[model samples]
Target: VINTQRAELEALRKKESKYKKAQEKVSTNKLLKDEIEHLETELKTFEDKDVEIGSLKLQTEKLSRANKALMNDIKNEQKRYDFLESKYKELLVKYNIAAKDLEKKQ
Candidate 1:
């Protein structure tokens, strides 16, 4: 009877060890699952930010193009103004010559 009890106790101890090992495996799997979920959320946020950055880059390109066009227009207007100023000076010189001729005749 004593030997039989000893064998039964040994079997029960083996089963307990197996149960502990299974519980540890489950706990480790749960931790891994939580880590995966966190990484997924982080990936989604980064993707959204990347899209927003792309949009801003496009807007910056458009603004740069618009600024270049405006600068060209200003240059053209400046050339036109200079041409008009030169023509006015020429007209004044012609008027002065005509006035001198009229004075001599009088």
Candidate 2:
């Protein structure tokens, strides 16, 4: 009877060890699953940021082109203003000369 009791005890110990090992495996699997989910979320966030960056870059390029065109227009307008100023000066001098000639005759 003592021998039979010893055999039963040993069997129970073996079962308990197997159960502990199974529990450990389950815990490890849960941890790995949670880690995978976290990584996936992070990857999605990075992809979204990449898309936003691309859109911003496109907008910056368009604005840069518009700025260059506006700069060229401003330069052309400056040249036109200078040309008009020179013509006005020349006309003023002629008018003054004509007025002096008239006063001398009188």
Candidate 3:
């Protein structure tokens, strides 16, 4: 009877050990699942930031093009003003010469 009791005790200890191992495996699986969820959230955030950065880059390119067009217009206007100024000087000299000639005749 004592031998039988020892055998039964040993079997119970083996079953308990198996249960403990299964519990550890479950705990490890939970940790891995939590890590995967965290990584997925991080990836989504990075994707959103990338989209926002792309939009800003596009806006910057458009502004640069508009600035170039404005510079070209300013240059054209400066050339037009220079041409008008030269014509005004030529007219003033002609008028002065005509006035001097008229006084001499009188």
Candidate 4:
């Protein structure tokens, strides 16, 4: 009877050890699943940020093009202003010479 009891105790101990190993495996699996979920969330966030970056880059390109066009317009306006100024100076000189001639004659 004692020998039979010892055998049963050993068998229970084996079963307990197996149960502990199974619990450890379950815990490790839960941790791995949580890690995978976290990584997936991070990946989604990165994808969203990438899309936002693309949109910002497109806006930047459009703004850059508009700025270049405005710069060109400014340059053209400056040239027109310089030409008008030159013409005004020439006309002033002509008017001054004509007035001096008229004064001399009178």
Candidate 5:
């Protein structure tokens, strides 16, 4: 029974402490009111920017992913172009050889 009472007392004390802090948030000590209000305003401003920062981070990630995908596509297209160019060069060589053979027969 004593242990249970102690635990309850501790819980109430924690709750009271939280309430006191909340009360201070609503109204601080008069002597430090101006300074505290300024600090609170600055803190609130930074907290408000949290969403904007998150959105910017998400946008940056998306753009980076898109850039990577585009680079890969460009690399694949370059490889395809190289393959076709090599094939064309090979056909040109074959045609030149055939032409030489025809000239010799003539």
Candidate 6:
């Protein structure tokens, strides 16, 4: 009877040890799951920011193209003004020469 009681006590101790190990593993698994969830959330936030940055870059590129077109228009207008100014000077010189000839004839 004494040997039987000792055997039963040893078996119970072994079961208790296994249960403690299982509890520790469960808690460790829970901690790992929590960390994974946090990392996933952070990754999603970064992805959203990346998308926003891409949109801003596209807008910047569009603005840059528009500015280049405006600069070209300004350059064309300046060239046109220069051409008109030269023509006006040439006409004035011709008019002055004609005025002098008429005075001499008179």
lDDT of each: 0.95, 0.98, 0.94, 1.00, 0.94, 0.98
Off by over 4 Å in 2: 2-7
- By lDDT, who's the top model here? 4
Poorly placed runs, candidate 1 (over 4 Å): 92-106
TM-score of each: 0.69, 0.72, 0.69, 0.73, 0.56, 0.69
For candidate 4, the 10 contiguous residues with the lowest summed lDDT are 23-32
| Residues 1-106, model 3: lDDT tens digits | 9999999999999999999999999999999999999999999999999999999999999999999999999999999999999999999999999999999999
lDDT, candidate 3, at 44: 92
* CA lDDT for candidate 4: 1.00
Q: How many residue pairs collide in each prediction?
A: 0, 0, 0, 0, 0, 0
- Residue pairs in collision within model 4: none
User: What would you estimate as the lDDT of candidate 3?
Assistant: 0.94
Clashing pairs in 6: none
Put down candidate 1 lDDT per residue, 1-106, tens digits, no spaces. 9899999999999999999999999999998999999999999999999999999999999999999999999999999999999999999999999999999999
Per-residue accuracy of model 2 over 11-77 as CA lDDT, tens digit each = 9999999999999999999999999999999999999999999999999999999999999999999
Could you give candidate 5's per-residue lDDT for residues 33-53 as a string of tens digits? 888889999999998899789
Q: Which runs of model 6 end up more than 4 angstroms from their true locations?
A: 87-106
- For candidate 5, the TM-score is 0.56
* lDDT by residue for model 6 (2-102), tens: 99999999999999999999999999999999999999999999999999999999999999999999999999999999999999999999999999999
Report the error of model 6 at residue 29, Å: 1.5
Clashing pairs in 3: none
